[model samples]
Target: MPIINLNGPKLSTAKKKELVKRFTEVASEVIELPEEAIIVEINEMPPENVGVGGELLSEKEDK
Candidate 1:
Protein backbone atom coordinates (compact mmCIF):
# COMPACT_ATOMS: atom_id res chain seq x y z
CA MET A 1 0.00 0.00 0.00
CA PRO A 2 1.12 3.50 -0.79
CA ILE A 3 0.75 6.13 1.88
CA ILE A 4 1.00 9.84 1.25
CA ASN A 5 1.30 12.19 4.20
CA LEU A 6 0.69 15.88 3.66
CA ASN A 7 1.43 18.55 6.24
CA GLY A 8 0.68 22.23 5.94
CA PRO A 9 -1.55 25.00 7.17
CA LYS A 10 -5.18 24.18 7.78
CA LEU A 11 -6.94 23.98 4.46
CA SER A 12 -10.40 25.18 3.63
CA THR A 13 -13.19 22.72 3.07
CA ALA A 14 -13.07 23.34 -0.65
CA LYS A 15 -9.32 22.85 -0.76
CA LYS A 16 -9.60 19.62 1.21
CA LYS A 17 -12.15 18.33 -1.26
CA GLU A 18 -9.99 19.32 -4.18
CA LEU A 19 -6.94 17.69 -2.67
CA VAL A 20 -8.75 14.39 -2.23
CA LYS A 21 -9.80 14.41 -5.85
CA ARG A 22 -6.47 15.47 -7.24
CA PHE A 23 -4.45 13.13 -5.05
CA THR A 24 -6.44 10.12 -6.17
CA GLU A 25 -6.13 11.08 -9.83
CA VAL A 26 -2.41 11.83 -9.71
CA ALA A 27 -1.52 8.81 -7.58
CA SER A 28 -3.31 6.50 -9.98
CA GLU A 29 -1.17 7.66 -12.87
CA VAL A 30 2.15 7.44 -11.04
CA ILE A 31 1.78 4.30 -8.96
CA GLU A 32 1.23 1.01 -10.78
CA LEU A 33 -0.26 -0.50 -7.66
CA PRO A 34 -3.96 -1.04 -7.19
CA GLU A 35 -6.07 2.08 -6.76
CA GLU A 36 -7.41 0.71 -3.49
CA ALA A 37 -3.88 0.35 -2.21
CA ILE A 38 -3.25 4.06 -2.08
CA ILE A 39 -3.67 5.98 1.16
CA VAL A 40 -3.50 9.73 1.53
CA GLU A 41 -3.42 11.55 4.84
CA ILE A 42 -3.48 15.30 5.19
CA ASN A 43 -2.40 16.86 8.46
CA GLU A 44 -3.10 20.51 9.12
CA MET A 45 -1.63 22.64 11.87
CA PRO A 46 -1.89 26.20 13.02
CA PRO A 47 0.82 28.74 12.29
CA GLU A 48 1.98 28.30 15.87
CA ASN A 49 3.01 24.75 15.09
CA VAL A 50 5.29 25.71 12.22
CA GLY A 51 8.73 27.16 12.48
CA VAL A 52 11.24 28.96 10.30
CA GLY A 53 14.91 29.30 11.21
CA GLY A 54 15.13 29.28 15.01
CA GLU A 55 11.72 30.65 15.79
CA LEU A 56 8.20 29.34 15.63
CA LEU A 57 6.14 30.78 12.81
CA SER A 58 3.98 32.60 15.31
CA GLU A 59 7.04 34.03 17.07
CA LYS A 60 9.11 35.06 14.07
CA GLU A 61 10.53 38.53 14.10
CA ASP A 62 8.99 41.10 11.84
CA LYS A 63 10.61 41.35 8.45
Candidate 2:
Protein backbone atom coordinates (compact mmCIF):
# COMPACT_ATOMS: atom_id res chain seq x y z
CA MET A 1 0.00 0.00 0.00
CA PRO A 2 1.19 3.46 -0.90
CA ILE A 3 0.32 6.26 1.46
CA ILE A 4 0.38 9.91 0.44
CA ASN A 5 0.54 12.13 3.49
CA LEU A 6 -0.33 15.81 3.21
CA ASN A 7 -0.01 18.24 6.10
CA GLY A 8 -1.28 21.80 5.80
CA PRO A 9 -4.00 24.27 6.68
CA LYS A 10 -7.59 23.09 6.86
CA LEU A 11 -9.77 23.11 3.76
CA SER A 12 -13.40 22.65 2.87
CA THR A 13 -14.82 19.20 2.21
CA ALA A 14 -14.99 19.89 -1.54
CA LYS A 15 -11.36 20.92 -1.74
CA LYS A 16 -10.26 17.94 0.29
CA LYS A 17 -12.16 15.61 -2.00
CA GLU A 18 -10.62 17.19 -5.08
CA LEU A 19 -7.12 16.92 -3.62
CA VAL A 20 -7.62 13.28 -2.72
CA LYS A 21 -8.91 12.43 -6.17
CA ARG A 22 -6.17 14.29 -8.01
CA PHE A 23 -3.41 12.98 -5.79
CA THR A 24 -4.58 9.42 -6.10
CA GLU A 25 -4.85 9.71 -9.87
CA VAL A 26 -1.34 11.06 -10.30
CA ALA A 27 0.27 8.79 -7.79
CA SER A 28 -1.36 5.75 -9.28
CA GLU A 29 -0.28 6.75 -12.76
CA VAL A 30 3.34 7.41 -11.89
CA ILE A 31 3.77 4.54 -9.45
CA GLU A 32 1.84 2.01 -11.53
CA LEU A 33 -0.33 1.20 -8.56
CA PRO A 34 -4.07 0.67 -8.50
CA GLU A 35 -6.10 3.68 -7.48
CA GLU A 36 -7.71 1.63 -4.72
CA ALA A 37 -4.27 0.72 -3.40
CA ILE A 38 -3.17 4.34 -3.10
CA ILE A 39 -4.08 6.11 0.07
CA VAL A 40 -4.16 9.87 0.61
CA GLU A 41 -3.99 11.06 4.19
CA ILE A 42 -4.46 14.74 5.00
CA ASN A 43 -3.50 16.33 8.29
CA GLU A 44 -4.95 19.79 8.88
CA MET A 45 -3.95 22.25 11.57
CA PRO A 46 -5.23 25.66 12.66
CA PRO A 47 -3.21 28.75 11.82
CA GLU A 48 -2.61 29.32 15.53
CA ASN A 49 -0.82 25.99 15.66
CA VAL A 50 1.55 26.83 12.83
CA GLY A 51 4.51 29.21 12.79
CA VAL A 52 6.56 30.74 10.08
CA GLY A 53 9.69 32.87 10.57
CA GLY A 54 9.09 32.82 14.33
CA GLU A 55 5.63 34.30 13.93
CA LEU A 56 2.47 32.33 14.28
CA LEU A 57 0.32 32.09 11.17
CA SER A 58 -2.69 33.46 12.97
CA GLU A 59 -0.70 36.48 14.16
CA LYS A 60 0.55 37.16 10.66
CA GLU A 61 -3.00 37.17 9.37
CA ASP A 62 -3.97 39.73 12.01
CA LYS A 63 -1.07 41.99 11.03
Candidate 3:
Protein backbone atom coordinates (compact mmCIF):
# COMPACT_ATOMS: atom_id res chain seq x y z
CA MET A 1 0.00 0.00 0.00
CA PRO A 2 1.21 3.50 -0.78
CA ILE A 3 0.32 6.63 1.10
CA ILE A 4 0.42 9.84 -0.89
CA ASN A 5 -0.09 13.26 0.65
CA LEU A 6 -1.02 15.97 -1.84
CA ASN A 7 -1.32 19.64 -0.97
CA GLY A 8 -2.63 22.34 -3.27
CA PRO A 9 -5.24 25.01 -3.83
CA LYS A 10 -8.92 24.50 -3.10
CA LEU A 11 -10.64 22.04 -5.44
CA SER A 12 -14.13 20.79 -6.03
CA THR A 13 -15.18 17.46 -4.56
CA ALA A 14 -15.24 15.81 -7.95
CA LYS A 15 -11.87 17.22 -8.86
CA LYS A 16 -10.46 15.94 -5.61
CA LYS A 17 -11.56 12.40 -6.38
CA GLU A 18 -10.26 12.71 -9.93
CA LEU A 19 -6.88 13.73 -8.63
CA VAL A 20 -6.79 10.73 -6.35
CA LYS A 21 -7.73 8.40 -9.17
CA ARG A 22 -5.13 9.85 -11.52
CA PHE A 23 -2.43 9.75 -8.91
CA THR A 24 -3.27 6.21 -8.03
CA GLU A 25 -3.29 5.06 -11.64
CA VAL A 26 0.08 6.62 -12.50
CA ALA A 27 1.82 5.67 -9.26
CA SER A 28 0.51 2.12 -9.27
CA GLU A 29 2.28 1.39 -12.54
CA VAL A 30 5.74 2.09 -11.14
CA ILE A 31 5.34 1.08 -7.46
CA GLU A 32 3.69 -2.29 -8.12
CA LEU A 33 0.97 -1.44 -5.62
CA PRO A 34 -2.70 -2.14 -6.01
CA GLU A 35 -4.79 0.89 -6.83
CA GLU A 36 -7.12 0.08 -3.96
CA ALA A 37 -4.23 -0.15 -1.55
CA ILE A 38 -3.04 3.35 -2.34
CA ILE A 39 -4.14 6.09 0.00
CA VAL A 40 -4.27 9.70 -1.17
CA GLU A 41 -4.66 12.65 1.17
CA ILE A 42 -5.53 15.95 -0.45
CA ASN A 43 -4.97 19.00 1.68
CA GLU A 44 -6.72 21.97 0.11
CA MET A 45 -5.53 25.32 1.34
CA PRO A 46 -7.21 28.69 1.07
CA PRO A 47 -5.55 31.48 -0.86
CA GLU A 48 -4.34 32.91 2.40
CA ASN A 49 -2.53 29.71 3.11
CA VAL A 50 -0.12 30.45 0.29
CA GLY A 51 2.01 33.45 -0.67
CA VAL A 52 3.94 34.90 -3.58
CA GLY A 53 6.28 37.81 -4.24
CA GLY A 54 6.43 38.63 -0.56
CA GLU A 55 2.67 38.89 -0.36
CA LEU A 56 -0.18 36.76 0.89
CA LEU A 57 -2.19 34.97 -1.80
CA SER A 58 -5.45 36.60 -0.84
CA GLU A 59 -7.99 37.90 -3.32
CA LYS A 60 -6.66 41.40 -2.77
CA GLU A 61 -3.18 42.82 -2.68
CA ASP A 62 -1.22 43.00 0.60
CA LYS A 63 0.13 46.48 0.11
Best by lDDT: 2
* lDDT (tens digit, per residue) of candidate 2 on 1-63: 799999899899999999999999999999998999999999998999999999999999998
Candidate 3 has its poorest 10 consecutive residues by lDDT at: 54-63
Q: Give per-model CA RMSD.
A: 2.1, 0.8, 2.4
**TM agreement with the true structure for every prediction:** 0.77, 0.92, 0.79
Model 2 ranges with Cα > 4 A deviation: none
Which pairs in model 3 have colliding backbones? none
Model 3 over residues 1-63: C-alpha lDDT tens digits?
689998788899999989998999988988987888899999988879777777677845454
Pairs with steric clashes in candidate 2: none
**lDDT digits (tens) for residues 1-63 of candidate 1:** 678788988899999888877887788778866668777889997778888787787776344
CA lDDT of each prediction against the hidden true structure: 0.80, 0.95, 0.85
Error of 1 at 55 (Å): 1.8
Q: Summing lDDT over every window of 10 consecutive residues in candidate 2, give the lowest-scoring window.
A: 1-10
Best by TM-score: 2
How well does candidate 1 score on lDDT at residue 12? Answer: 92
Cα error, residue 21 of model 1, in Å, equals 1.4
Minimal lDDT window, size 10, model 1: 54-63
